[model samples]
Target: MEASKRQETARAPALPWTVRFQIFGLVAAASVAQRLNGTVNRSFFSLVDRHVRASARPDKFGVRSDDVDVDASRGLWARVFKPSEAQSPLPVVVYFHGGGFALLSAASVPYDNMCRRFCRELGAVVLSVNYRLAPEHRYPAAYDDGVDVLGYLEKNRLQDPAVQVDLSACFVAGDSAGGNIAHHVAQRWTAAKSKSIRLAGTILVQPFFGGEERTESERRLEGVAPIVNMRRSDWSWRAFLPEGADRNHRAAHLTSENADLAEGFPPAMVVIGGFDPEKDWQRRYADLLQQKGKAVQVVEFPEAIHGFFLFPKLPDAGNLVKEIKAFMDKSKASASSA
Candidate 1:
């Protein structure tokens, strides 16, 4: 009997490292290690990012892409994508890639592919910003990088004929952390007195925001979602924000106190997942925007979870693209009429 049991145990396949770590609850341990050892974490995260980014499909479908440095001194860069057949100037989408403000880049394969899809579907020139990540670059750094990218686009509008972007119809879009950055950038653009480019709209896909108080969704989905969980979300906040800063910081929480700032924001489309832990906050933000008399629309994926758009094969991904296209079309119509 003992020999039979030993043989059966030996027949079981070994689990992958990631699976093993998750099974043993070492994932959180690694996150703690990341907070303690910056170099090690950066190296590990970079390796994973490289693998993921390498999986991006080649730029086919008549979309042309070029890497451009927005700010040499600050190491700010962007990947610009435009449809090859666009004769007239195309609407500009200043896109930000999401990785909890610490992982991934604009150059990542998933992000690059996403930008290509945006260019193809919306018939718009997409400038995907490669903002610096955190633990190395903390809060307001990414936000500043976003503003600088916009400023660079405004100053160098005609630098590339192949990518002639319509600055007047500029829109901002992002998912997760990128969504949060997009919102902040739009607010800053509205407040800036010397703004040159005009914003037509903002699209936020599953924005990552948190406060000192936990929402029911967060409590229910803690350590539950396949992509993002409460613990991971909390860890990201710690790594991205200034040292010792809490969730109540304005950078994390867009509260009623600062709701007035959103008044000048352009029309916005806030997308949220029904199962996302951050859905409550995202909904609150949309409501706040509406209450402030700002034009806002909310789109909910009732059966989806966070990061659904990242997976192109998912049915929700196609639905999201269609929704965004419709919104942009409506905005364009409004702009033409005005």
Candidate 2:
């Protein structure tokens, strides 16, 4: 890790003057928004996302993507990415994007581009789920939408017979708030014992989880880490959790001593950022899974901060892609053997 860190520092390029200036202004605005209510901050953040968002371009990295409907009446839809010349029966990854569960969407520039990279590099199809957001549709809405997407997949097709996908090889994955949704969705899906779709595993990248008690990491990294800080994190929890609910709610707090797992919860790969304020809680979640005798893998990026996976130029981001591919392959083999 030390060598990788040194190499990354040597190779990482500096941001252009214009981009740096834009970042400076954005950060300044955020500093002010932090004092306002979560709703206003959410609106401001959404505007920023709309301005920088990349559209659904299919040809990037030889991966073709299109909008797929799940339940248009409820405004539930997703973006599907399929790599060129993909072999039949390839693994399918259902991905959820991170925005503290209140901001950002599947169409957000970074997430769209990241899914394209996953399709090309991993040689698999990626379904970027656009689950309903919080405050507007709080609590079980996102989680329910997640399970609904699986249900939709079971009944529908990729619409391309040339490139068949293995539903049995299906995997649920997400980053940040999406990661939290991924875990709950997997639990519900597995509990139902859906014979049509087998959840091979889950990939949680810097998953968002919290509790009433602040961990050492949270207190120490409060204002140091970028994007995710103590104040904004708390606001997100309030918005996403049920009304009048506190951080200790079951949805936000999954590390309770008596927390229970679904009977067939799949294997998990937990990514940790050393500099992230939530690392302590992330570690606790992984520990709970391990204590239950679940097959879990913890991948840590020592110098990485929160939301590190969203940046492509970062060495850690590329390394994470490789790690995800390895986990998919290993989990697939294990599932087949079982």
| Candidate with best TM-score | 2
lDDT of model number 1: 0.79
What does candidate 2's lDDT look like per residue over 1-338, in tens digits? 97685344333234446544554555565555444555645566655565223334448466777888899999999888886555567889999998778777888777888898998888788999999987688999999999999998888857586577889899999999999999999989998989998999999999999999998778766655566778888888888898899999989788646467877899999999877889988999999899988889999998676777776656789999999999999999999899
lDDT for residue 211 in candidate 2, whole number 0-100:
91
Positional deviation of 232 in candidate 1, in angstroms?
A: 1.2
Give the alpha carbon lDDT tens digit for every residue of 215-267 in model 1: 87776666555567776778788888889999988988887786557445799
lDDT for each candidate structure? 0.79, 0.83
Error of 2 at 278 (Å): 0.5
Candidate 2 regions with alpha-carbon error over 4 angstroms: 1-35, 41-43, 51-60, 256-258
Q: How big is the positional error of residue 227 in model 1, measured in Å on the Cα after superposition?
A: 1.5
| Runs off by more than 4 Å, candidate 1 | 1-33, 36-40, 51-58
TM-score of each: 0.86, 0.89
lDDT of 2: 0.83
